[model samples]
Target: MLDRYGFEPAREAPDRVRLRNCPFHPLAAQAPDLVCGMNHAFLTGYLQGLRAPAVQAILAPSPGECCVELQDATEDGEGAAD
Candidate 1:
């Protein structure tokens, strides 16, 4: 979706992983259960809020890739890493 939006990932320190702009960082704190919840419904809710004008945009799997990657990261035990 970032590519479609003409936005590239912003790199952060330590890890070369791409960073993303999330004005909704506050929601993440509210959804502590998001990453661990069933089917990532909390994240889906958070996304729905991000693309309110075009609800269909949130349905696209391209954006969901980030969530999938997050899942992999957590599964790899990175969730507990310092």
Candidate 2:
């Protein structure tokens, strides 16, 4: 499922999903802020469009991994800003 969106999803915890690779590596390398922000927005909308409103896309950059992560919005009252 995630593969189709260029993400190799990994579960770090019950409510957290990490991405192993970035499809827009070249562009991200050139402009991490711009690219990551766009990715976050896109993922957020994507999740909502899929009717998965509980899942939120966040920009959580990590070394050797994609900058975006998907987490359950039910945790700690944390979720994407509406």
Candidate 3:
């Protein structure tokens, strides 16, 4: 689904995956909070629907970087941020 959103993998690590290219560029530039939030929700739902309880979507937006990052979920079923 990242491809469908025009995001391509930029970096990969044991715990995280960074993606680049925003399909919603212009709109994201206009409202980062909204766009990023939606992106996060979409990814979260996607992962949940796939029954991937060990993975999660994180909102770690960066310029020229993916608005979301797929990361290993912590033991509490939450991402590292918690």
Most lDDT-accurate candidate: 2
Q: Which parts of model 1 are misplaced by more than 4 Å?
A: 3-8, 12-15, 35-82
Candidate 2's C-alpha lDDT?
Answer: 0.84
Which is superior by lDDT, 1 or 2?
Answer: 2
Model 1 Cα lDDT, one tens digit per residue, 1-82: 5444422444333332332433233553466345324224544454456643222111112332332212222333434232
- Each model's C-alpha lDDT? 0.34, 0.84, 0.79
Could you arrange the candidates by TM-score from highest to lowest? 2, 3, 1
Instruction: Give residue 17's error in model 2 in angstroms.
Output: 0.6
Question: Each prediction's Cα RMSD?
Answer: 12.6, 2.1, 3.2
Candidate 3: tens digits of C-alpha lDDT, residues 1-82: 6776688865578878787876788898899888888888888898888988778888887897668988788934654444
Candidate 3 TM-score, C-alpha based: 0.82
lDDT of 2 by residue, 6-68 (tens): 878999999899999888888889999998888888887889889887888888999767899
Best by TM-score: 2
Model 2 bad stretches (over 4 Å): 79-82
Given candidate 3, what's the lDDT at residue 74? Answer: 91
